[model samples]
Target chain A: MIATKRRLPLPLAALSTGFVLLWVFVAAFPFIWTVWGSFKVEQDFFSRDSWWFAIEGTRTIAQTGSAFTGDGYYGAWVLRDFFSSVVNTVIVTVSVVVVSLTFGTLGGYALARSGYRYTFWLLMLALVFRAMPHITLVSGYLLPFFEMNIWGYMPTAIIVLVAINQPFTLWMLHSFFLSIPKDLDESAMVDGCSRFQAFRLVVIPVMWPGVITTGLFSFLLAYNDFAVTAMLLSQPNQTMVPKIASFLGTIQQEGNVMFAVAAVVSATAPLFVLVLFFQRQIVSGLTAGAVKG
Target chain B: MPHRAFFAFIMPSLVAMLLFIALPIISVAVQSFYVQHERVVTEVETCTPFAGCTKETRVDAEATEKLRNEEPLGRFNGFGTYLDRNHLAVSEIGAILSDNAGFKDAAARIYNLPFYRALAFTLTYTFVVTPFAMLLGFCIALGVDAIPPFYKGPVIFFSLLPMIVTPLVGALIVYWMASSQGILGATLQTLLNDPTLSLKSSAAMTWITLLVYGIWHNAPFSFVVFYAGLQTVPHDTLESAMIDGANRWERIRFVVIPHLMPLATFVGLVQLMDNFRVFEPIVGFSAEANATSLSWSIFNDLRGQVDQLFGSAAATSMLTIVGVIILLSPVLVRTWRDFNRR
Candidate 1:
C-alpha cells in the first residue's frame, strides 16, 4: 500500500534493500557467531588464523575427529550446578507472574470499570513508579531484609520481584482491561450475578490474551532480572544472569570463556522461543499504548 | 462500581504498592539522612620500667561493639551524605570554583566527582541515543513498508530479536563480538595496523561502542511502532498527495512524517526513560571503568565490602528518582490533560 504506485525508483529501492539487509545482519550475526563459537574449543575459536574460525571446524576438532564439542555447555550447566539456578529462576518467575497478574488484573479491571477521579490518579501513580529505576528499591530492601534475617532467600527475592513488576504490569493490563467492553459484565450482573461473579463469568474468559501478554512481560522481568536477584539472593540462590556474570568474572582466568558463551546462549534460548511463538501478541502489546494514546 | 467492590479489587495492588513502592521510597529518603560508621576502639598499653619500652594504644573491641549496638542505624547527618563527594560534592564544587579554571578544566574537576560524572554520561547517552534510534527506526519502517509483503515478516522477526532478547544477553552477544579477541575488534585492530588497538582500550571508543549498541538494540522498537503507525496513515490522503504531483520524497516528508509524529513522541518518551536507567550494558561490556550511571553507582555503594553504605546508595537512588520524575513530568502532564479531557 505504501509503494506509492510508482515504478520509477531504482537507486532508492536498492538503498532500502541494502539498509534492511544491513540491519538483518547486524541483528542476527552476533547470535549466530556466539552459538557457533560456543561449540568450538577456545584455542581454535580464537586461533587468529581466520575470521572463518566459527564456520570452519577447528584443528583440535579435526584432531579429535569430531565436528563439534559440548565442553562449554557441560562446563556451565553441569559443573557449575546451573540446574539449581534454572530451578530458582523458574520458581521466582512463576510466582512473580501469578502474583503480579492476579493483582494487576484485579486493579486494572477496577480502574477500567470505574469512572471516578481517583482511578486517574492511581494510574498516574503507577506511571511514576514504572518510570523510576528499580535499583532504588534495592537499597531500601537491603537494610530491612538484613535486619529481618531474610536477605538472601528466594522468597524475599520473589516478593520483591513481584513488587517491582507490579507498576508495569498494572499499566499494561489496565489498558488491556479498558479494551474489554463493560457491557458484558454489566449484563452478567443484571442476570443475578455479583460483581465478582460477573468478572469470573464474563470478563475473564475474554481477558486471557491480555493476561498472557502481561504474564509474558512479568515473566521476562522476573526471569531476566539481574539487579534484584543479585542483590537479594546470596550465593546459594543466584539465578542464571548473575551466575553468568560470576562466571564471566572467574572463568576468563581459568581458560573457560566458552562456558559463559554457552550459558548466554542458553539464557537467551527461551526468549527466542517466546518471540517465535508470541510475535503477534508481543508486537500488539508493545504498540497498544502508543496506538491508543 | 460500588465502593466495597472497588475497594476489594484495588486493595491488593494498593497494599503491595504501599508496602513495596511507597514504603521503600520513604525509607530510602529517611535512610539518606543517616550514614553508616564503624566504631574505632582505643586501647592503652602500659610498659614496664625495667627495660626501655613505649606505651601503645590499640583498638578496644568491647567499646566498639557497645557503640555499634547502641545505634544500629548509624549517625544521622541530615543530607550530609547527599552533599558528600560521592553524591553532590558540595565542597569539591567550591574548590573547583575557587581555582578559576577553564570550562573543560572545571568539567573535568566535576567529572572527578562520581555522581556528576554518572549524570553526564546518562544524559548524553539518553539524548544521543533516543533521536538517532528514532531516525533509524523511521527509515527502516519506511524501507520495509516500501518492500513487497513477502519479505517483511522474516525481516521483522530478525529485527525484533535485538529488542526482544534479554537486554544483558543482547549486550553480551554484542560485547563478545566487540571484545579485543573477537571478530570486529580484531578486524578494527588490523585495519588500524596497531596490534594493541582495541575498542575497550579507550574511553571515547567505549562510549561510541555503547552508543552504537544502544541504537542497535532499541531502534527496532521504534521501527515496529512506526511500521504500525504507517498502516494507519490515511490512504486517501496519500492518494490525494500523489495526484497533486508530489514525488515520493515530498509525500513522505509532507504526509507520512506528520502522520507518525505521535508514535515518534511515544517512542521518544519511552526511550528516554529506558536510556536514563541504563545499567545492563555497562555490566555486560565491563565498561565501568569508562562509564558509570546513577543506577550503577547505587549498585556500587550497596556492594561495599565492610559496610553496605545504604545511606549513600539511598541518596543516589533519591537523586535518580528525582531525575526520572523531572524527565517524566511533561509526559505525566500530557497524560493528565488527556485524562481530564476524556
Candidate 2:
C-alpha cells in the first residue's frame, strides 16, 4: 500500500503523470521523427498536404510503389566521402582523450595532494581558462600558425583540443582525487616506495573509475566540438561536426538537404549509444560537481 | 607528493597550458593593440622624352612582402580597434549621448555597431536562458518525481538526449522541425490559421525559437541535478509538514525548494558560463541575420576568406573575456572565499 501522507490524490497523480509523459514526448519525438524521416524521400517526408505522408509514403515513392529510400545515406556516405571525416573525428577524439587524461591524472593528483599556495592559484587559473570560449584562442592561433605553416593540420587541432580540454579535466580530476583518502599513498610511501611508485601502485588502481568518468567527458568534448574544429582545421582535415557544417553550407545550392539530414542522424547515433551504455558515468560525472559544490 | 614529484607531475600540463592557453590570451591582447596592414611603397615613374609617357604610381609587391616579413605584427594602434565602431563604439555612444536621444532611439543607434549589437543579444541570451532553464528544469524535476519509480530511468534517458547530442546537431534537429515544411512548423501554421506564418520569417519568432531550443537543450541538465537533490530531501520533514496540513505547493515552497537552493546555484553557474559562449546554436539556426553574439562576431571576423580581420577579432575576444569575468565575478569571489576557508 502507498503511504497515505506522501501519495497524492488519483486525479492529481494522473494529471502529473500525463504532463510528464507529454514532456517526454516533446523531448524524444524530434530525434525519432528525424531518424524515420532520414529514410524517406524529401517530398514525402516533408509533405505539404499531411504530416503523416512520410509514414504513408510520398507522391513519387507512392507512384513508384516504394515507401523508403537510401539516397540521403548513399549521397552522404558514398558520394560525399564522409567516412574520411569519421576517421578524422575518431583520431582526434582518441588522441585528445589519451593525452588529456595522462596530464589530467598527474596534474590533478598533484593539485589535490599539494598544500602550496600555487596549487590554489593554478586551479583558479584553470577556472579562468575554463570559462574562455575556444573561438578566442582560435583567433590568437591563426596568425602564428600561418607564419609557422601549421594552420590546417589534424595534429595541430588535436593538440589544441587537448589543451582546451585540460582545464575541465584538471578540475574534475582534482575534485575526484580529493575524495580518496591520502593515507593510502602515504602508507605505501612509508612501506618503502617513492611517491611516484606509491601513486602508480596505490593511487592509480583506485582512480580508474574517476578517470574513466573524466575521460568520457573529455572524449565528448573533443567529439562534439565544432567551433575549434571548424575554424582551425582546413577543408580536407575537417572532423565530423565540421563536415556536417560544410554540408549545411552547400546544402541549398547542391540540393543535398537529405545528405545533411542523414549525416545528422548518423552523427547522433553514437551519442545515443554512448548515453545508453555510459549513462551511469555521465550522470555521476554531472552530479559530482553538484554534490561537491 | 613531495615538491620534486609535484613539479614533475605538473610540468607537462603547465607547459601545455602556458603555450596553448595562456600564450594565446597574451597574443590576442597584443594583437588587439595592432592592426594588420598591407605594405605599400609609393614609387614615382618619371616621363622620359623617348617614352613620351605620363608619370604613374604603382604598388610594389616585393617591397610589400619584405615589409610584411620584417614586421609581421603590423603597426601598433593601442586601443584604437577597441574604441572604433566595430567594438566599444565609444565615439558613436558619445554622439548618441550628446544628442540626448530617447532610450529606444539610442538603442537603435547603438545596435548599428557590431560589438554592441552582439553584446545585446549575448546578454539577452545569457540572462533569459539561464533563469528559464532553471525554472523549467525545476518543474520537470517535480513532475518526474511525482511519477512512479519504474518510469524514471527511461524518462531521464530520453531527457538526456537533447543535451547529450552535440549542441550544433541538437540545435539543427530543433531548427529543422521548426522549418515550414516540417511537421511542427506545418501544424503550428495551421493552428494559427495562417498559411504564411513561419518561424523562419520573423525576428521575434527566431529569438523565441532559439530560447526554446536553449531551454530544451539545457533544462535536462538542471533536471538531473535537481532530481538528484530531490532524492535527498528528508522524508521526515516532508511527513511532518504533511501532518501539519501543509499542501503540496506549501510543502514544496517551504521545504523542497530551500533544500535545492545550493544545487540550483551550481546549475546556474555552469549554465551561465556555457550559455555565454552561445556560438554553435546561432550558426546552426542560421539566425545570424536576426541574432549575433560576441563569439559569433569573433567567428565572423576571422572567417572571411580573403579578408581576415585579425585585430578586430582579437579585440572582440578580449572584450568577451572581460564580459565573462564580469558576469562570473560574484561566483568567483564566493569560490575564492570558500577555498580560503577550506
Best by lDDT: 2
lDDT of 2 by residue, A45-125 (tens): 677788888777766476556777788899898899888999999999999999999999999999999988889889888
* Candidate 1 runs further than 4 Å off: A2-8, A62-64, B50-55, B62-66
In model 1, the number of clashes is 1
Q: What is the interface RMSD of each candidate, in Å?
A: 1.4, 1.9
In model 2, the runs with Cα more than 4 Å from the true position are A1-6, A60-65, B38-62
RMSD of each: 1.7, 2.2
Over the true interface residues, superposed, what is the Cα RMSD of model 2?
1.9
Residue A268 CA displacement from its true place in model 1, Å: 0.6
lDDT (Cα, tens digit) per residue for candidate 1, span A1-293: 54463463899888888888898898888888888888887766665665666567666567556768898889999998887898888888889999989998999899889888888888889888878787898888888778779989998888888888888888888888888888889999999999999999899899999999889888888977888998889987898888888888899999888889889989988888888888888788788867764
Query: Per-residue CA lDDT of candidate 2, range B205-289, in tens?
Result: 8889988999899888998899888888988888898899998889889999999999998899889999999999999999998
Could you tell me which residue pairs clash in candidate 2?
Answer: none
Native interface contacts kept by each candidate, as a fraction: 0.68, 0.72
